[model samples]
Target chain A: GAGVSQSPRYKVAKRGQDVALRCDPISGHVSLFWYQQALGQGPEFLTYFQNEAQLDKSGLPSDRFFAERPEGSVSTLKIQRTQQEDSAVYLCASKLKAPGQGRNEQYFGPGTRLTVT
Target chain B: AQSVSQHNHHVILSEAASLELGCNYSYGGTVNLFWYVQYPGQHLQLLLKYFSGDPLVKGIKGFEAEFIKSKFSFNLRKPSVQWSDTAEYFCAVIRRHSGGGADGLTFGKGTHLIIQP
Candidate 1:
């Protein structure tokens, strides 16, 4: 793909129902990130991966929030026991490589709008 | 913990008017700053970035930003805004390479700009 792509432009899930969002980053990119944006709010960092390594998950709000980048090319963000407060747009971004000592340009996807009822 | 603040929630200006949007971040170490713009029904796109060197950095579409290290601020500016420039703007900060996880960015709440013709 020419740019990062997120699936299910919009999702509606019943409270307590689990949901998973997918991200396909630009081919060969080494860094991937996931973020959550509330209405009228900035996107908050959720997690970060570097070539299959989940280096940071500090931004995940709860234990139910989990992310994985098994092969390093694709990533998934899964929320268990979804809550109404979880409703927000999930953004995915990828960079050509790790940020440090290199050009750190992130290309963002259109984002997945998730609504938990 | 690092965080970003964008004081203005909404701003209205006439076309051809000069514009400046304020952004502040809290971080003790070195940081990389970026400005992103999101037009209605569109994805977020980078306007400009500042990694090092001169404090002033120019970006696409005649947009520029100045990074003030002492104030921990990165303010975006445009000599003249057009109707098409109406959109939401985001400011972000990335931990220096030494801090690691450079891919993750902490973003401001974002400012909605409305350029009326």
Candidate 2:
């Protein structure tokens, strides 16, 4: 089975430009998550979605970050204005069940590395 | 706020050497623990998780982690490591969301393991 996958494996964006990263979760996964990993650091949570509802966005760094999963399978994380601080690897993960359903494993994607210059 | 700590930032061991990486988290409430591995050039993959039941949980590839609630720790151990086990290991925790709401995972700084054959 195909695992979670993110598009645009690498991206270089100018400081004020907008960028959107896409994620395709596993076929039947209803829970999806986003994370950010800076160099020499582990990934930090970004946001989470259950089906098409954005359940948690507390981890997002700032208001410039926004995410949506309209169809519940594919998600897009859009940054309103790229910044040098936004340079990092953006990871996407998906789980088969919602929180507290007893499953705890989340399959991750290759992640998209974004560099803002 | 919950925070995870990985005691070792980097570990180097020869093939067939015993390995143990320490991880501790700070959160008084109920939580779930997980260990994830990321091989070079690959996505993050789950090694194991501890939600309930026995404290010792075995994961893929000869790995096991013990959750010590009293100590606020979930340490990953392997009797003997292989060269292929060289990768980045991360310890993560999530607050138990029982009824409905969802939350994001809080990950540690991660351990970079280098195996020498």
Candidate 3:
């Protein structure tokens, strides 16, 4: 793909249900990022991956949020026991270079808007 | 942890009006700054970026930003705005060397800009 692509443009889930969001990064992109954006707010970092390694998960808000990029190409973010507070847009981005290496812009995908009822 | 702050929650301007959006960060060390815009029904797109050497950097669509190291601010500017420019803008920063969790970006609350014609 020419750009990052995410699955499920919108999702409606009941409270306590589990939801999974998928992201397919551009080919050859070495870095992938996940972010959460609540209404009226900017996207906040949720986790980061360099290749298949989960280099940074410090930004994940809770233990229920889990992200994995198993093969360095596609990634999945799963939220267990969803809550109303979890309602937000989940964004996926990919970069061509490693962190701290040089200047590379992160290209974002059309995020999945999740609504927990 | 690094944090970003965007002062303007909402802004409105007429066509051809000059525009400026303010952004500040909490980290004191070396950082990379970026401005991203999200149009309605569209994905987030990079507007501009500032990394090293030059404090002023220009991006597509007549957007520019200045990185002020002394004040830890990266402010976005445009000489004129059109109705098509009405969108949400975000300021983001990446810590250069945090050792463990450096890859993910810290973003501000964003500014919702409405360029009225």
> Best candidate, DockQ-wise?
3
Distance from true position, residue A42, model 1, in Å? 0.3
Residue-level lDDT of model 2, residues A39-75, one tens digit each, is 9999988989999999778788999999999999999
Per-residue accuracy of model 1 over B34-65 as CA lDDT, tens digit each: 99999999888999999889999999999999
Which DockQ value does candidate 1 get? 0.84
Candidate 2 residue-wise lDDT at B67? 92
DockQ pick, better of 2 and 3: 3
| TM-score, model 2 to reference | 0.96
TM-score of 1: 0.96
Q: In order, what DockQ does each candidate have?
A: 0.84, 0.79, 0.90
Q: Would you list the clashing residue pairs of candidate 3? A: none
- Give per-model TM-scores: 0.96, 0.96, 0.96
Chain B alone, TM-score of each model? 0.93, 0.94, 0.94
Fnat, model 3, is 0.95
Once fitted onto the true fold, the runs of candidate 3 whose alpha carbons sit more than 4 angstroms away are B96-101
Model 2 interface DockQ: 0.79
Query: What is the lDDT ranking, best to worst?
Result: 3, 2, 1
**Which stretch of 10 consecutive residues in model 1 chain A shows the poorest summed lDDT?**
A96-105
Listed per candidate, the RMSD to the true structure in angstroms reads 1.6, 1.7, 1.3
**Candidate with more favorable, higher DockQ: 1 or 2:** 1
List model 1 lDDT by residue over A36-100, tens digit each: 99999999989889899998887899999999999989999999999999999999999888767
